[model samples]
Structure formats: C-alpha cells, structure tokens
Target chain A: MKLLEDRIRQDGTIKPGNVLKVDQFLNHQCDVALFDQMGAEWATIFACKPIDKILTIEASGIGIACCVARHFGDVPVVFAKKSQSINLDGDQYVSKIYSYTKQREFPVIVSKRFLTAGEHVLLIDDFLANGKAMNGLIEICKEAGVVIEGIGIAIEKGFQEGGRELRAAGYDVQSLAIVKSMDPDQGTIEFA
Target chain B: MKLLEDRIRQDGTIKPGNVLKVDQFLNHQCDVALFDQMGAEWATIFACKPIDKILTIEASGIGIACCVARHFGDVPVVFAKKSQSINLDGDQYVSKIYSYTKQREFPVIVSKRFLTAGEHVLLIDDFLANGKAMNGLIEICKEAGVVIEGIGIAIEKGFQEGGRELRAAGYDVQSLAIVKSMDPDQGTIEFA
Candidate 1:
C-alpha cells in the first residue's frame, strides 16, 4: 500500500469539497501495471478466502477488477451495469443507488445466471466514498444468495463512513490506500 | 482467435435484431484468462506498431483494454468517459456517438491531458458493428493529434459495414471473431 499511497501523494489532486482526482492514472486513464500490483496485494490479503467471482460496477471498476482477477486465479469478473441494456435478459438482480459523481439514481444490474447460490464473491471497485455503490452490490449479492467473501477497494476515504460501516456489518473490507484527510487549498493528503 | 470463436459458438446466444449475447464470458461476466489470451493475440497482431497508450471507451472496453495492456508492455489504458462527470476537467476532446443497444446518443470524452500530440495509440473495443463508437474515438484521436497504430476489436459483425468501412478508411482493424451470419431462429452462427 506504500506504493499506492505514494502514487496518490504524487499524482492526486485535491479539489474543493474534498474531491481527490487521480484520473491521470487511476480512473479515466489507467495504469495496468499498478492495477496488477494492487491485485497482488489484495490477493495476499484475501488469500484465505474462497473467491469464485469478482463483482464490480461498470466503467471505472471494470479495469481494476479485470486486472485484479488475474491474481485471484483468473476469476470471472461480473460487473453490475449502471442501466438496463437491451443485451440483458429478464432474469437479473437489480439494485438502485445514487451516484454522487453522476448525480442520479441508476440501477446496478447483473444476470441471475452469473451468480449461483452459495457462490463466494469478492466485490471490487476503484473508490469507496459514501458506500452507496458498494451497498448496491451487496444488496444484489444478498438477493442472489451468494456468499460475500470480502470487498477489495483501491482507495478508501477513511473520513467517510463507507469503510467503517462495512466493517461494522462484519464484512472483511480491505482497502489498499485509506485517506485519513485531504486539503484542497494547500494540496495535501494524509493516509491512515 | 480460434479460442474466442470457439467460446462464442459454445456460450454465445443469438437473439433477435442480429444480437449475439456473449455476456456469459465476454462483457458482463468477464473471463480474465480468455481476455489475457486475446491480449496476447492482439499483441502479436499490433507488434510492429509503437503503442504508447491503449485508448478505449468506458465500461466494456476498459476490462479488455486493461487486460490487453499487459500484452503490450503495460501501456497506459485511457478509457473515454461516456458522459461529463464533475471529476473531469474543462479541457477535453469530446465526440458524440449513437449507440444502438442503448438507443441514445452519448458523448465520448477523453481528457486532453491524457492524450498527447505525436503519441502512438491503439484503439480497443468489445464490439464493432456500425463503427459509431470507434469513429468517435478516432475523431478524438485525430483532434488530439495522436498516431493511431491500429484498432483492436474482440468481435466484429462482418454483415455490418463497420469493419469494412474502417478498413476502407485505411485503419488496421483486427477482429478476433468475425461473424459472417447468424440465425436466431435456427440458433446457428457462421464465422467468416
């Protein structure tokens, strides 16, 4: 996690309202090598768990989950699409969540065939802010009767309650980099 | 290529409206091992080009492009955002594209900072039908003044004009699986 913390310190920019932009390497533009390394770290952390699949959301989470899947024995990565697609079938587990980034509520959908009963699934994503998106996935997981193995997040805002709430719910959430605090004016960030 | 073709034949379903759903292993639920093999295949095909970055659209393309980046020496994978997010800056290369699956027009946006002038880029996507999305990326690449070495596609509908038109436009488009024809009624598919 030192490498990720350092990368965030070097490349991350803090904007007004506590927005940390790491798009140069993390989100919009991705560094696959870094993703692979993050995968290795998460694999080490979740070595004891049985991970049958990696569940993630669309867009940002797909790259990280796909790259990380290699470390988890090339597990099938099931991404929850943001909206309904014509390609999707009627048998789907859907959960609605509000995305502060997009500023709208969209349904996270996954085919029921992908998640079987008693399957161990590890949820993965780029960032865990307020836990709305992760909560959506967890809701679908509950509905599908899949076992929640763990949640692997690249960056977690410790100041936010997402990570704390999941831990309180008795979930093993492993975040690579936890931001304790950040300053937009002076451009500074502290890790937990 | 044969591996992908075989996968499609086995798991792909032919729906009405010329839709071939391979969500079991390709887009929704991703098989990272298969994606790595595709990366290897594309690496071999685009070996001669100097690829500085792998450019793709959001969602489906991000997973394949990230997995494929490993085969291309860990090149940076820049995914075009489908909409304008508050996280994105003002300086951007924007192109509008119409999606048949979503039945709407969306903006394809790439941050100006990620793309540089005179850089070699390889465009990647999950599917190429009418080439609207690909063309949008190409337009951004042109505006950014980047050199497009090639366009790598996982599947191309040979019955559609996307691949043929791209080839006629003097782009090296490599599609692993090209569908010559498919019958939804008969549940049969023929590869080109």
Candidate 2:
C-alpha cells in the first residue's frame, strides 16, 4: 500500500473538484508493475478469504481486476458490462447506477452463468467515490446469492462517503491508496 | 497458439449468425492463466519488434492488454476510451468506429500524452471481425506518429475481411486463434 501511495504522490495530479488524475499510471495508461504490486498487497490483506471469482465493472476496473486475479489462485474475472451488448444474452443479474463522469445512469449486468449462488467473490475497482457503482455490484452479488468476501479498491477518496459507507455496512474494504484530502491550488494530497 | 485453439474448441460455443462465443474464457469471464499463455505466445511471435507500449480499446481489450503487457517486459498498456468522461481532457487523437454489438458509431479517443511520436506500439484487441475498430486505432496511430510494431488479436474471423485487410496493409498480425468457419446447427468450429 505504501508503494501505491508513493506512486500516486509522485505521478498523480490534483485537479479542481477533488479530482486526482492518476491516469498516467492508473486507469487510461496502466502501469502493470504497479498493478501487480497492488495485487500482491491485496493478496496479503485478503489472504484468508475464499475468493472464487473477482467481479468488477467494465472500461476501468477490467485491467486491474485481471491483474489481481492471479493473486487469488487464478480465479476467473467477471467484468459487469456498463451497457447491453448483442454478445450478452440469457438470464442476468442487473443493477443500475449513476455515473457522474458520464452524467447518466448505466446498467451493470452480469450473466447468471458467471456468478452463481454460494460463490465467494471479491469486488475490485479503480476508484470508489460516491459508492454508487460499488453498491450496484453489491446488489448484483446479493441477487446472485454470491457471498461477498471483501472489496479491493486501488484508490479510494476518503473524504467521500463511499468507502465509509461500505465499511459501515460490515464489508471488508481494502483500498490501496485513500486520498484523505487534496488541494488543487497547492497540488498536495494527504492519504488516510 | 495451440493452447488457445484447444481452449476455444473445448469451451467456445457456436451461436447463430456466425457468432463463436468464447466469453467463457476469452472475454466476459476471463481466464488469467490462459491470458498469460497468450501473452507468452505473442511474446514469441512478435519477439523481434521493439514494443514500447500496448494500445487497446476499452471494456474488452483492457484486461487482455494488461495481461499481455507483462510478456512485453511489463510495458505500459494504454486503452483508448470508447466514450468521453470528465476524467479525460486535453489534446487527443480521436477516430470513429461502428460497433455491431452496441449498433452505433462510437469514438475511440486516446490522449496525446499517452501515444507520443516515435514510440513503438502494438495494437491489441479481443476480437477482430471486420477490422473497423482496428482501422480506427491504426488511423490514430498514424496521426500520433507512433510506429505500430504489430497487431495482436485474441480471435479473428478468417471469413471476415479484417485480418485479410490488415495483412494486405502490411501489418504483422498475430491472432491466437483464427476461425475458418462455424456451424450453429452442428455446433462445430474450424480453425484456419
């Protein structure tokens, strides 16, 4: 976690509106080595959990989830699609969530064939701000009857309620880098 | 590539309209071990090329590209965004492509900061059918002045013109599994 926190401090940019742009090494342009290190940290943190599969949302979480899957005994990574596609068919567990980035609501869908009942799963994502997207995945997991082992987040905005709410709900949430507060003018970031 | 070919033959489903659904291991629900093997194979195939980074699209390609980057000496993986978001800003190289799954034309946008001039990149994707999406990436590469070392595709529909067109354009395309044809009624898939 210290490695990730350090990398974020070194390469992340603090923008207005509490935005921490770590795209240079996090989401858009990925640093696989850092992701692997993050996976190592998560594996040690969630070492006791029975993770049968790694569930995440599309576009952003896919890469991180895939890299982390290796740390959990090569479990299959099931990425919930943001939109309905021709390839996705059959019975599905769907949960809708609002995206402030896209400024719209999108459905997070996973096939019933992938996430089954009684499967222990870990939820992974790049960021958890408002927890809307995290809640959607939790809803799908609840509907699918899969046991939520824990949640693994690469970056969490500590000032936001997403991480706090998940922890309050008794879910084991392990965030690599939690931004306590960020100053755009001073370009400083504090971690929790 | 035989490992991938065999996996496809075993787990891949033959669907109507020439759809070979390998989402069980290839895309939707990913098998990381298999992806690791794919990365190994691509490493051997494109061994001589100087690959500075890996470029792919969002949703599907991100996972595979991240996995494949490890085989390329842990190179950075840059995934082009299929949609605009608050996270994305500044100068970008944009190209439009039609998605048969979504049934709409979408823009493939990559930040100029990621894809710089004189960098050698390898274009990667989950599926290459008509090559429209690949073409869009190619156009962006041309505009960005990046050298495309080669193209790595998980599966290619040989009956489609994408592979042929890319090959005709003098691209060293290395597809793990190329489907010669598929029978929905018979539930059979042949490789090229």
Candidate 3:
C-alpha cells in the first residue's frame, strides 16, 4: 500500500470538487507492473478464502482483475458488462450502479451461466467511491447464489461510506491505497 | 494459437446471424491461463519490434492487453475509452468507429499524455471483425505520432474484409484464431 500511496502522491493530480486524476498510470493508461504488485498483495490477504472466480465491472476494473486472477492460479475472471452488447444473452442477473465519477446510474450485467450457484467469488475493482458499483456486483453475486468470499480494490475513497459500510457489514474488504482527502488549493492528497 | 483454436471448438457457441459466442473463455468469462498462452505467442511473433506500449480498445480488449503487456517486460497498457468519462481530460486524440457488433458509430478517446510521438505501439484486441475498432485505434496512434509496430488479435473473422484490408496495407497483423465461417442452423464453426 505504501508503493501505491507514493505513486498517487507523485503522479496523481487533484482538481476542484475532490477530483483525483490518475489517468497517467491507474485508469486510462495502466501500469501492469503495479497492478501485479497490487494483485499479489490482495492474493496474500484473500489467501484463506475460496475464490473460484474474480468479478469486476468494466472497463477500468478489467486490468486489475486480470492481473489478480493470474496470482490466484489463473482463476477465471468475469467482468460485469456496463455497455449493452449483442453477444450478451438477455437472461442475465442485472444490477443498477450509480457511477459517482460519471454521475449517472447504469445497469451492470453478468450472465447467469458465468456465475454458478454456491461458488466462492472474489470481487475486485480499480476504485471504490460511493460503493454503488460494489453493491451492484454484490447484488448480482447474491442473485446468482454465489458466496462473497472477499472484495479487493486498488484505491478506496476513505472519506466515502462505501468501504466503511462494507466493513461494518462484516465483509472482508482490502484496499491498497485509501485517500482520506484531497485539496485542490493545496494540491495535496491525504491518505487514511 | 492451437490452444485457443481448441478452446473455441470445444466451448464456443454459434448463434444466429453469423455470431460466434466464446464468452465461456474469452471476453466476458476470461481464462487467465489461456490468455497467458496468447501473450507468450504474441511475444514470440512481435519479438523483433520494440513495443513501448500495448494499445487496445476498452471492455474486452483490456484483459488481453494487460496479459500481453506482462510478456513485453511489463510495458504500459493504454486502452482507448469507448465513452467519455470525467477521469479523461480534454486533451485527447479522438476517432469515430463504426461498430459491426452493435451496428452503430461511437467515439474512442485516448489521452494525449499516454501516447508520445515516435513511440512503438502494439495494437491488441479480442476480435477483428469489420476492423472498425482497429482502424480507429490506428488513427489515434497516427494522430499521436506513435508508430504502430504490429497488431495482435485473439480472433479474426476471416470472412470479413477488415483483416484483408489491414494486411494489404502492410501491417504485421497476427491472429490467434481465424474463423472462416459460422453456420447457426447447423451449429458448426469452420476455421481458416
């Protein structure tokens, strides 16, 4: 987590309204090496759980999920589709996710076949803000009758309630870096 | 490549309207082991080229790009955003792509900072159908003044004109599996 926090401080940009721009490495442009480290760290934490598949919501989450899946003995990764595609069957477990970054509510979908009943699932994502997306994925997992083993995230907005609420609910959630606060005036990021 | 072809023959489904669904392994439900094989194969093919970054389109392409980047000494993977996001800055190289899967046109955006001039870029994608997405990515690389060293595809629709056009234009394009045709009525897939 120290490496991720340092990377954020070095390359992350803070704008008005607590906007953290990490496109240089985290989102738009990805650092696969860093993701590998983050994945290794998550694997170490979730080593006790039975993770049959790693679930994440696209498009940013795919990179981290793939890297993490590698460390888990090449476990299958199932990404919840955000956009409507012809390839996806209509009979899917759908959940609504409100994107704080985009400020819109959209449906994230996963086929019923991909997630089997009673399978242990590990959820991963790039960022956790309001936890809407995480909740949506959890709902989908529940509908599929899968057991939620744990949740892994690269960055968590500690100031937000998503991480706190999940922890309060007794879900094992691990975040590599938690941003406590960001100040545009001071051009600084505070970590929890 | 043989492993991927075998996976398609075993798990791929043929739907109506020339659609071949391999969601069981590729795209939606990703097999990290198979993806590692593909990454190794691509690394063998594009070994001579100096690839500084792996460029791919969002959603499905992100996973393969991430996997492939690891073989290339953990090169940066830059994915083109299909839709506009608050995380993306105003300074971007944009291109319009016609989607054969959805039968629509959409914009692909890449931050200008990620791609630098004269850098060697390897374009990676899950499938090459009509080649609209590949074309858009190529255009973005051109606009950014980056040299596209080669292209790596998981599957290529050989019946379509996309691969033919790109090859005629002298791009070193490599496809793991090339589907010659698909018969929905017979539930058969022919590969070239």
Candidate 4:
C-alpha cells in the first residue's frame, strides 16, 4: 500500500473535479509490477476468506483483477460486461451502475453460467468513487445467491462516499491507495 | 501452447457461425495460470525482438497483456481505450476498428504520452479473427511513429483471413493456438 501511495504521489496528477489522473501507471498505461504487488497485498488481507471467483468490470479493472487472481492461486476471474455484445447470450444477472467519471448510467451484466449459488465471490476494481459499481456487482452476486467474501480496490477516493458506505454496510472492503484530499492549484494529494 | 490447446479442446464450446465459446477460460472467465503459461510462451517466442512496451485493446486483452508483461520483465502494458471518458484527455492516437464478434465498428484510442516514437511495441490480444482490432492497434502505433516488433495472439482463426493478411504484410505474428476448423454438430475442432 505504501508503494502504491508513493507511486501515486510521484506520477499521479491532481485535476479539477477531484479527478486523479493515474493513466500514466494505473489504468490506461498499466504497471504490471505494481499490480502484482497490490495483488499480493490483497491476497494477504483476504487470505481468510473463501474466494471461488474474482469479479470485476470490463476495461480498467481486468488488469488488476487478473494479477490478483494470480496471487489467489490462479482463481478464475469473471468480468461483468458494461455493454451488451453478441457473444454474451443466455441468462444473465444484470444491474444498472452509475459511472461518475463517464457521468452516465449503464447496465453491467454477468452471465448466469459464470456465477452460481453458494459461491464465494471477491469483487475487484481500479477505483471506488460513489460505490455505484461495487453496489451493482454486489447486487448481481446477491441475485445469484453467492456469498460476498470482500471487495478489493487498487485506488479509492476517501473523500467519496463509496468506501465509507461499503464499510458502513459491513462489507470487508480494502483499497490499496486512498486519496484523502487533492488540491489542483497546488498539485498536491493527501492519502488516507 | 499445448496446455492452451488442450484446455480449449476440453472447455471450448463449438457454436454455429464459427463461434468458439471460450469465455469459460479466455475472456469472460479468465484463467490467470494458463495466461502465465501463454505469457511465458509469448516471451520465449518474441524474446528476440526489442520490446519496450506491450500494447493491447481493452476488456479481454488486458489480462493476458498484464501476464505477458510480467514474463517480459514487468514491462509496462498500455491498453487502448474503446470508449472515450473524462480521464482520457490531451493528444491521442485514434483508429476505427470493426469487430467481427460484436458485429460493429468502434474507435480505439491511446494517449500520446504512453506511446512515443522510437519505442518498440508488441501487440497482444486474446483472439485474432478478421484482424480488424490488430490492424487498428497497428495503425495507432504507426501514427505514434512507434516500431511494432511483432503481434501475439492467444487464438487465431486460421480459417479467417486476419492471420494470413498480417503474415503476408510481413509482420511477425505468433499465435499460441490457431483453430484450423470447427464442426458444431460433431463438436470437433481442428488446430493448425
């Protein structure tokens, strides 16, 4: 976690609208080495839980989730698809998620065949903002009657209610780097 | 490569219209361990080239790209974004690609900062059908003035023209598993 925070401090840019531009290393242009480290950290924290599958949203979260799956003894990773595709057919557990970054609501879905009843699922993502995506994933898991083991995130905006709301709901949520505050004018970031 | 071919033969479903449903282990639900094997194989194959970075498209390619990056000494992996978002700003290299599976064309964009001139990039993807995505990625790299060392694909539809076109164009293309043919009724698959 310290390594992640340090890397964020060194390379992350603070922008208006409380956005942290970490595309240099975290999302667009990824640092797989850092992802492996974060994966190890998540595996250590969630070692006690029974994680049958790692769930995530498409695009950004897939990289970190894949690395985390490696640390979890090569557990299978299931990513929820944000857009409906021809390849995705059959019964699916669908939920609507509001993307604060994209500033819109879209449907995220996982095939029913991928998730089943009584399975212990660990949800992973790149960032936690308003907790809308997490809630959507949780909703799908609940619909499938699967047990929510925990949620692991690469970065979390501490000023946002997503992390706080999950913690208040008694979910074991862990974030590698939590941004406490950001000052765009000063180009400064405070981590929690 | 044998491991991947075997896994595909075992779990891969043969649907009509030449659709190989490998979502169980390749795309939707991913096997990181197998991906590491594929990565090791790719690294061994592309070891002769000077690869400074691993480039890929978002969603499915990110997982294998991350694993492949690890095998390449933790090289940075940059995934081109399929959709535009707030986080993506500044100069970008964009290309339009037609999806054979999704049955539509979309734009793939990469930040100019991540890819620069004189860098050797290796493109990685889960599947190579018509090669539209690969072509799109190659176009982006060309626009950035980056040298494409080669292209790596997990599964190449040999019946399709994509692989043939790339090889004809003098690009070093390596596919771990190339499906020569598939019979839906008999549930049979042939690999090239």
> Whose lDDT is greatest here?
1
Clashing pairs in 2: none
Native-structure RMSD, model 2 = 0.8
In order, what fnat does every candidate score?
0.96, 0.91, 0.89, 0.89
Q: What C-alpha lDDT, on a 0 to 100 scale, does residue B191 get in candidate 2?
A: 93
Stretch of 10 with least lDDT, candidate 4 chain B: B97-106
lDDT of 2 by residue, B1-192 (tens): 789889988999988977788889877899999999899999999999999999999979999999999999999999999999888999999999999877899999999999989999999999999999999999999999999999999999999999999999999999999999998898888899
Predictions' DockQ, in order = 0.93, 0.91, 0.86, 0.86
In angstroms, the error of model 3 at B166 is: 0.5
Q: What lDDT does model 3 reach?
A: 0.91
Candidate whose DockQ is highest: 1
State each candidate's clash count. Answer: 0, 0, 0, 0
Isolated chain A TM-score, each model: 0.99, 0.98, 0.97, 0.98
- lDDT (10s digit) by residue, model 4, range A1-192: 899999999999988999999999999999998999999999899989989999999889999999889888888999999988778888999999988777788899899999989999999999998899999999999899999999999899999999999999999999998999999999999998
Interface root mean square deviation of every model, in Å?
A: 0.6, 0.7, 1.0, 0.9
What TM-score does candidate 2 reach?
0.99
lDDT score of model 1?
0.95
lDDT of 1 at A168: 99
Stretches of candidate 2 above 4 Å error? none
